[model samples]
Target: MHLRIIALALTAVLTSCAGVQVHRVTDRNQPGIRYWRPAPYLALVETRTENAVACEVRPLMLPDKTEEYAITINAGLGSVKATPTLTDGWNLVSLNAEADSKTSENLTALATLLKTGAEIKARGVTKPPTQPVPTCRGVFRVDYDAAGNFKGFSRISL
Candidate 1:
């Protein structure tokens, strides 16, 4: 009876961890990138220089298993919608920058870094001043490679 209770507890913990994987990944071959879907969840990627990337990609998985993603960028300044095609269960979606020219250039550089095994820490929080709050607010120090992704994410007070 005690063994059965322990098994059930372990299963509950593992099941919750499987949802929305947020951790440090050094190897470019890690499987986290395969499950990174930027849609239906608000991903707020803020850089060290305070240049921010806030947008969500709504993925429409078609009958043929291809996905079409859509999102609007920069709500206050101007809105720009971007669509990227996903196939073969993996695809790199290019997020077009809607900020000023310089900020846009910065985001391009960051995107390149993300594609090259750079680790970004993700957490869930309530963003301030917005009636409808966001789900995940990822704070990434533009320099940390793969150290801070995994540890102490749960200790972060929401």
Candidate 2:
């Protein structure tokens, strides 16, 4: 009975978002009693800068999969939705960033660092806002220039 109410509430929330489409991604990679959906995209943006490529990630996935949530990004030039993936070990998931010969290492480092931070936060070394309820959070949007250079990132929270 409780599960049904939760499912109904989630459906109602997801049904209310705009633009971005939502799809179910099951873990054919893993098996057993579990499941997860990242979040809905509220908006996306694409912009450029000299030293860093910044994507203003808006609302993003809650670390705890059981809650209803969404993610967004602000790219001045605009943005596109990418295929989603299971964000390893975190128990949350993420969207893939465009691959680039120009900035892959930097982007990869940024991503890795952030993921480490999230993991640490979840572990309670640093009391994060989500600390009260440690969750699997993923950074929402990634930035790539016209040349496909990944520059920076922003993770989703709540």
Give each model a TM-score: 0.19, 0.19
* Cα-lDDT of candidate 1: 0.33
Query: Tens digit of lDDT per residue, candidate 1, span 45-110?
Result: 333445765544222211211222222233233333333334444433333333332334335533
> Compared with the true structure, what per-residue lDDT tens digits does model 2 show for residues 16-106?
3322222233434432223243322322344569887554334434344543222222222233333434454333344443332233333
For model 1, the stretches where C-alpha displacement exceeds 4 angstroms are: 1-72, 79-81, 88-90, 93-158
**What's the C-alpha lDDT at position 67 in model 2?**
34
Q: Positional deviation of 87 in candidate 1, in angstroms? A: 1.4
CA lDDT, every model vs. true structure: 0.33, 0.38
Q: List the RMSD of every prediction in angstroms.
A: 22.9, 22.1
Tell me how far the alpha carbon of residue 144 in candidate 2 is from the true structure, in angstroms, after superposition: 38
Candidate 1 similarity to native, TM-score: 0.19
Report, for all candidates in order, the number of backbone clashes.
Answer: 1, 7
* lDDT top scorer: 2
